[model samples]
Target chain A: MSQWLTLFQKELLEMWRNFKWIWVPITFILLGVQEPLSSHFMPQIINSLGGLPDGAVIKIPPPSAQEVLIKGLSQYTSIGVLIIVLTTMGLLSGERKSGVAAMILVKPVSYESYVTSKWVGAMLLMWGSFLIGYLATWYYTGILFKWVPISDFFASYFYYGLWLTLALTVTISLSAMFLTSGMAGFLSLAIVILMNVVTSSLSNWMEWSPAQITTYANKLLLTGKIPDSLFPSSLLALVCTIIFLLVGIFVFKRKELASS
Target chain B: MITINWGLLAPIIIIQLILLVVALIDLVKIEKTNGPKWLWAIIIIVVNIIGPVLYFVIGRRNH
Candidate 1:
């Protein structure tokens, strides 16, 4: 127990040293604030482009607060996801590559605790930054647009957070499986992208897919209603996260850490 | 020519500045980066939000 606490603290100290704590949340806040700001200024921005004929009446209807919030969140699916995957991609692979994993494992630390501490530390960083960023976006959306229902906002926040959790877990597990951080990052991203592709192309049958959480989150934002499959889908995602954690621990336990 | 509510936009600008400053400080202080330090400093400054993030992600070699 104490060992896990010490290891977790080390993970956090490492993150602090690398400036992960500083840049990551700043990036999230930046990302969060952009959507509402852009949506709020769309008409003027269009007019300033100056390509239209004289006296052109651009008739873009003002987006609803819900739509603005949803659009803001859409940025997360792309740039936000990429940032998360990039941030987490090196969790295990980098340690192993630098021979730090061997140094740590040589001690009395349990493999499960070591891997779990890393996962927990990464989770803290991701969730903390995400919450700060999401709140920044929410605050901006409220200021520039109508206030969304607090119930709906919280619901969508957890659902989107779960999606991020799943992405981070997959990246960590894959990092455990690979020696090269690049390969781990690439494959984890490919897997996430493939899941979105498959889920979209087969939405009819993918009701229980974790990727559908975003769709469900959008639904909550738009209609403020929970779908029937939300629980099952969330459960499945949770299970997948656990399975990935187990796989990561299993792989880490067996894999050779010293690369040189 | 587009007018922005600076009060509303100031936070985002400040957030970006924080990221830039932190990345620059790290670049200057770190012993060895994955690539040239000057190149990273340029990237951290010139590329807006993504440059600093890229520097953090791939620039500083993990010791």
Candidate 2:
């Protein structure tokens, strides 16, 4: 128990001392502020453009408060996903690159504890950034539209955050198993894009493909209807999470850290 | 995005399984080399689901 705490503390301190905390929160906050702000102002900006000299008249329809909120949340998802991927790309790979892993292994810490602590620390940072971004977006959207359901706003963000965090955690675990930090980050991004593309391409044939979990969660938050498709994807994501985490630990335990 | 299409899911699973099998074969062939076989195996098996990008980037033999 003491070792675990010490590991956690060391990991946390390394993360903070590295200034990751500052950059992550800054990035999330920027995403949060941009989402609702853009949704609220885009229409007005377009309208203010007036008619073109070529006789092109763009009729900009006013978006409802709900529409704006949903748009903002979706934008948040895009930016948040990118930030999570980049931030966690080297969570473990970086240590290996910097020769930190060899030194750490020489200490009293077990491989399980070391890897698990890194995982937990990464999760904490990811979740904390996500929550801050979600809350900021939710609050700003409510303020701008004056029609958001305040009671359900937090709940919706929580659900979305869980799915996003799980997806990111799996990505990080896979990244840790790879050799290069750049490869880890690139692979993580590719996996996300591939999931979306394959799922959409097969949407007509395969009603559910783990990718639907995000869409379903978004729908539930935006429309309040939980689709049956979400349940299966949710289960799949959970299973994948467990599998990836275990594999990561197994690989790390047997890894020759001195080589890196 | 939450829709059901078993047909789509089937191909995904099959593709991933095939990749996993190919990666395992590659792992066996390269196990005795000086390179890091486990790292290559993981990259090929796990990251190859997104294609062979990671494998090409970090898994292939350095020679």
Candidate 3:
């Protein structure tokens, strides 16, 4: 356990030096703030465009606070996820490439702990930054629009957080398998996008899909009701996350580091 | 042009400026990057939020 903690602390220090600690949260906050501010000033922005006819009346109904919050989430679903994948692309691949993995494994550290420590470190940065950004978005939504109930805020946060966990897990596993960080990052992104697209297209049969986590989160935010499949979907996501972690460990053990 | 609320929008601007500043500092301090350092400096300064993020993500080559 102490060994794992040491490895985890090392992972964090590396992230801090890489500026992941700074850019990730700040980018998320920027995306969060952009959503509400743009929505709040939508009418003014449209008028400023200067393309409308003289005395043209564009009647865009003011979006509800829930809707604005949902929009903020979409920003996360796209740009936020992109940033995350890019930032953590080098998680395992970089270590292996730069010969750091060989040096670490030469010590008394367990392979399982090493992989788990990386996952945990990435998860900490991801979840911490996301929570801070989401709260900022929620606060802006309340001030500019209506206040979202705290219960719904938390409920949606939990579900979305699960989805992000799944994304990070996929990246970690891929990072372990691929030698190149760019390949791992892009392949994981492709899988994530494909999962979302497939689930949406086959929504009738894909009720228990891990990709449904985002849809369920959106539902919770828009309507204060839980989907019946929420538990199953969350369970499946958790299972997948664990499975990916094990796969990462297995691969990391088998593959000889370039340094070795 | 509805009267712009600088007070309400100040935080976003401040956060963006911080991103710009951080990216610039890193660029100056780092020994090597994936591409030309000058190009990164231009992207960081000119490209808004995305520029700095791009510089951080793909610009700096980890040695």
Residues A129-245, candidate 2: write the lDDT tens digits: 777766666676666666567655665665566566666766667666876767877777788778778987888765666666666766776687777777777777678767777
Which residue pairs does candidate 3 place in steric collision? none
Please give the range of 10 consecutive residues that has the lowest summed lDDT in model 2 chain A: A17-26
The per-prediction i-RMS, to one decimal, reads: 1.6, 17.1, 1.1
What TM-score does structure 2 among the candidates reach?
Answer: 0.73
Best-fitting candidate, scored by DockQ: 1
Candidate 3 docks with a DockQ of 0.77
Give TM-scores of the second chain, every candidate: 0.93, 0.58, 0.94
Better model by lDDT, 2 or 3?
3
Per-residue accuracy of model 1 over A56-76 as CA lDDT, tens digit each: 777888899899888878878
DockQ of each: 0.81, 0.02, 0.77
- Give candidates' CA RMSD values in order: 1.1, 15.0, 1.2
TM-score of each: 0.97, 0.73, 0.97
Over 4 Å off in model 2, which ranges?
A: A47-57, A204-206, B1-63
Of 1 and 3, which scores higher on DockQ? Answer: 1
Per-residue CA lDDT of model 3 for A1-260, tens digit only, reads 98899999998998888888898899899888788899999888888787898887888999999989999988888888888888777889998999888888999889999999999999999999999899999999998999999889888888898998998899999999998999999999999999999999999999999999988888877778888998899999999999998999999999988753
Query: For candidate 1, what is the DockQ-based docking class?
Result: high
By summed lDDT, the worst window of 10 consecutive residues in model 3 chain A runs over: A251-260
True contacts kept of 1: 1.00
